[model samples]
Target: MTKTLGRRLFGFGSSGRSAARNPGGATTAADCLRLYDDAAAAGPVDAELAEAAAAVRQLPAADPGMTDALLALGGAALARDLPPLALAAADAVLTRRKGSRAAWHLRGRALEVAGDLAGAVEAFEGYLERTDAASAGAAEVTARIAVLREAHSWRQDVVGALDGTAPGVGALAAGPLPAFEAALGRHLDDRLAAAGPEEAAGLARVVGLHAERRRHQLLPPLADPLQGGTGRLRIGEFRNLVAGRSVCLVANSQTVGGGALGADIDAYDLVVRFTSFRIDPAATGERTDIHVTGHRGALNWDRRVTTRLVFSDRPEDWRQALRTRLVPGAQRFTGDDSLRRPLRTVGGLTPERWPAPLTCGFEMVWLLDFLDVSPRLDLIGFDFFATGHHRLAEAARIAGPSDYSSEKAWVMERAQHVTGPVIALR
Candidate 1:
């Protein structure tokens, strides 16, 4: 990346300085080193950073500290919004040490900032190859790769659509629902072809439901689901409702119905449940503070529920639910379709190649954590889709498109960690 190109893309001027000087009016290697450290920590364009960069350039060709200095300067440059300088520093380190993992990681970040998505992927992959896959660093890089790849694909689609080179790109404009339905159709077809008669019959029902959803788009898209759209409560408003208060999230797993935790669940400050949840007073809670559901299936809205939150990647699906499934006298809320990919980045919980849509239950977990809702958040009846025993018959019969294994692992890991809210698995 050239300085001129960086300036044009990032709208920042280049740092200009001649050399580093001490109070005694003389420059030394120690002073230069200190300046580099200060610049890296400060993370801004200033006389100190410019002087450090100039002094580093004057170092001896084979200086032993050259690589380290360059790495530090690269980080400083990246923090200061100088992608060109960061890129140059990363390149210098790689040239000196071909297998330098830090250099490749730095290059990847700089490329990402410079809007070179492809190059960023290449550099990050290089870093991943050199790092241990079992390490936390590897997990973070894997998540980063997933995000970058999605961004790259979305950017390509946009460009192709603008140039009249991509025909189905318009499907994206409608939201992820169209693409999800197409993928689900293919998945069902492949499974049906290989399944026994009984399994095939169940798969056919799923296909029928999918088709019904498409045929029932009787209304136009709903208003945006973000804060300023429709009757949705602001994120801050929801946060205030739950912050510092005990919260319980009840799932539809059959295992829950076997237990007698209803009173415990209802005792919390708030009780939340997913779509089609059962109401066995002794097993499941009777109170419904919030009801969360997707666009598909029948919405059995409880009369006592105070709020209804709808989640769908497709605006049309949300609109359909609002028109056909919404219950009166309840506060309504929904998430923006655009938040799907970005929300996946929350807690780095998603797998490296998750093409399927997230389940409404999993999204609620992520949202609660993102909002820092409460100190103690209880998870009831969640077996991560294991045993496939849902309260609703159709839900138990058909497997949805979500990656259950990944969601389970993410929740398990979060439960084991100490940083976030205490996610008590019941």
Candidate 2:
């Protein structure tokens, strides 16, 4: 594992830097240690990281203080995806550096990569506490501690709130539509009262789906219940940040009625990033710029989702196209095409789409505002996540990746809801 660890560092897809660098005229123990420290800060999977990892491995063989370097190298190896090697390297470091924080950090990272988040968190916390207060990367280590804490908090909140429950919008079984409606209405009203009219309308539409699902359980309705998509969708806006000339608002909602029965929830998860905003510096008019996609809900299920919108002095033509054209085109798929293609198209002015690896600092304001006028849908609720572009970008990176699995892919497909790791267990 130790031998292969060096080679594994060579094929990383991202940066190509080493974890450590050799400064001029420095071969002393202090200089070597400092270089290894620099390498860790530079990051693992770097050009010098391999050398640093090797140096650390060898350092402990000669000097005891170099045990810290050995431990750090193990963490670097794991970050570089050389797990077996990382395990061996970390073990080597821990053998001599028994109680050193760097060794523990490496072990923690290795465990984390091995899918032991809890264990990893414990080790990282211990390492942070043991490390010197004035370490070069102390701030970063502190930030990591915060991140782990937040992730833990968020995970707990989600589990406590929704764990062991169904994972779908349909979790509100049809047997209790009246109760569901009452409860849902109260929830919506309480949370969304302060939102704009458009947001309120959009949110109401999402709630309306609950009512519709109660009447027909895979059975046809006696007649088309009111013209479909005719009502205004509700949007429940929550947080709003005042940008220089524009305002960045974060809104979320329980969007029901977007999918038909037996729709997939594991399909590609949709992330709406707000790119830029168009606001009048002179006048206080409201306008924003953004892109939206992932229309094909979950696993290519036919669902109308508005990804992004660009507002203007006149009106957002592209947004209307999404509501009128692209969404309908996606609805036409008869299970033959890939479920994701509907929301993954390009080269059309209608819903002007872009490829994946989406831009950050963008949001779905147009749809959020549009939800206000469209009443047939429900806009559950929105959360104010960040204040500005920097925060927004940070939020985007933290939102994690999407899950796009088909309904047919899991045995629990018929259940009202699904939770915890959306993907099917191996």
Whole-model lDDT, model 2: 0.35
Worst lDDT run of 10 residues, candidate 2, spans 234-243
lDDT for each residue of candidate 2 in 43-77, tens digit (9 for 90 to 100): 44466456655655465356743554554455555
Whole-model lDDT, candidate 1?
0.60
Misplaced by over 4 Å in model 2 are 1-76, 84-88, 134-136, 165-426
User: Residue by residue across 1-426, what tens digits does model 1's lDDT show?
Assistant: 333333444332122111000011232344434544544454445664565476476778579556666766676677666654566666677767768777778778776666555667788888789875754346667899898787667545443423432234333322222343465456556667898988766555455654555565556776532322234333433554566688888888766777778888889988988887778989886888887787775756534466667676555565566666655545444332323223453344455555457777888887887777487787776777564555755456555655588778878877733322225842
lDDT of each: 0.60, 0.35
The true-versus-predicted C-alpha distance at residue 104 of model 2, in Å, is 2.5
| Steric clash pairs (candidate 1) | none
Q: Model 1, residue 374: what's the lDDT?
A: 85
